[model samples]
Target: MKKTMLIIVLSVFALGCKPKQTVANTKLDNKTERLMKGDWLVSSVKYVGSDVFKVTSFNIADAKCFEESMWTLVSNNNTGEVVLNKANCATFESKITWYVNKDGNFVMKFLSEGIKAKHTTSGYVLKVANQTETSFQLIDKAAVGSNTAEIVFQFDKIGN
Candidate 1:
């Protein structure tokens, strides 16, 4: 009878200790950090056409030169490295860092320009259009030669 009573009391205590809400509350910043932790691949690049309204998309697979390119994002310190896996392109890595700014836009900073010259000194400040466990979409408005265009970058998580 003593053992039974003790077990019943412990069970009641444990049950009461559990959080009232089944799902723990997660802050938006923390949630974004969690989702951003991974090795991502450039799935596609889309650009606004001459019409300035029409959009044209190009898949990485469609470009035979780029086969296994990947962007490894270090979640802890908002740092990362870009590897452009192509025979013609220089294999040397370029340092990269990224984070969500106060405005909620996703900003990427390149410490050094890679051999491929992915971005300019200004870097890229892109808005996160969508994000999920496996994929994310970033959009930016930038000058394309003589005209301003909308650039959409699509990335898919390849690894943790």
Candidate 2:
């Protein structure tokens, strides 16, 4: 009876102590990590309560002048970073910076210095959804006011 009770307690303790693991940690590789480091293509975009724009081709550059940085930005028209999407005509100079949060997810800042607004700050978590030699998708856990949404960007490696 004592042995049976001990076994039950052990099982309960073992279940409680189980470690959490993620699938991305297993499959992620060095090459994939490097591809993520550089600039790529911004293929699609959607704004909250705003119009939808499907980007056929736009450059995403790693703004290394600062660290913990990523940008899903379009060229500023006045700033002369112009990749037009028809004549609808709106370009963003968005910057996304990353740091590990207390929740163990990436904490990001989405900001822009652009023709529309100055010093705009947005927050998100960019999780690696999928990746390959030429392209990858990042799932942005974006938050605005009391609402939250996901944003994705598919990028192709430059000169690779």
What lDDT would each prediction earn against the true structure? Answer: 0.65, 0.43
In candidate 2, what are the lDDT values of residues 49-105, reduced to their tens digit?
Answer: 533422222133221111222233222211112132323344334444444323334
Model 2, CA-based lDDT:
0.43
Question: Candidate 2: where is the Cα deviation over 4 Å?
Answer: 1-33, 45-89, 99-106, 112-122, 141-151
TM-score on alpha carbons, each prediction: 0.58, 0.38
Best by lDDT: 1
* Model 1 agreement with the true structure over 134-158: per-residue lDDT tens digits: 9887776755568777776678988
Query: Which pairs clash in the backbone of model 1?
Result: none
- Candidate 2 lDDT for residue 24: 28
Q: Which regions of candidate 1 deviate over 4 angstroms?
A: 1-28, 50-68, 86-92, 113-122, 145-147
